[model samples]
Target: MTHRRAREAAGDKDVLVLGVDVSRQMLGSGLLDEVHLHLMPVLLGAGAPLFAGVRAELLPLGEPVGGAATHVGCSVVFGP
Candidate 1:
């Protein structure tokens, strides 16, 4: 889906809902212009799936973004 449609589906002003991609051993976030709420429960277990596509460059939320995944153990990474 296009990034613009994604945001309109999210319907939020203060928060930017993008995409989160997860592979066999890697997790990454994307900065799409929008995020589709309809796809929240969708999961791709093969290869590196695209969480979202953005037309512009994605900006990082901070220097270091840390998080805890129930299945991935401890993970510390940056977001864009």
Candidate 2:
């Protein structure tokens, strides 16, 4: 589901939805304009597939933006 549609469905101005992870069915619905991924460089033998639905290559947006999580950020194409 697109962010706008999800927001409208919930009838709330602020709605947090999960866009990543393999479980999510919607990824490249051509609804979003941009997609951000803050990932840690690690090799987990088994876990939730990263960018399972993400097809486009990620491009660095700017300098490393850090938060509670230590990760390297990249921007991926959201739509055509």
Candidate 3:
């Protein structure tokens, strides 16, 4: 869904997106409020970077929840 559609569908609720390109679009367009990153142990080389075209911004991460994968939550801070 486009950002407007996503916003309308997600009124006063959270939307979990699993696609990298979609996430990039949301983040770049300043449509994301927070980000939760699930880091796994295994790595498969050759893929698009998460923050590829997004501008530099500070993302203060909260305490990580660990398990088979580590989950880290970050609040998106927009603008200088």
Task: Estimate every model's Cα lDDT from 0 to 1.
Answer: 0.36, 0.53, 0.79
Residue range 1-80, candidate 1, lDDT tens digits: 54457567768753443334422112233332322222223455653444333223334333433344221122233344
RMSD of 1: 10.0
The TM-score values for the models, in the order shown, are 0.25, 0.44, 0.78
Give the distance in Å from residue 77's predicted Cα in candidate 1 to where it truly belongs: 20
Q: After superposition, how far is residue 58 of candidate 1 from its true place, in Å?
A: 1.2
Residue by residue across 26-60, what tens digits does model 2's lDDT show? 44454433345555666466657645665566676
Q: Rank order by TM-score, top first? A: 3, 2, 1
Query: With candidate 3 superimposed using the best TM-score fit, by how many Å does residue 7's alpha carbon deviate from the native?
Result: 1.9
Each prediction's total of clashing residue pairs, residues at least 3 apart in sequence or on different chains, is 4, 0, 0
Best by lDDT: 3
Q: By the TM-score metric, which is better: model 1 or model 3?
A: 3
Runs of candidate 1 with Cα error greater than 4 angstroms are: 1-44, 51-55, 69-80
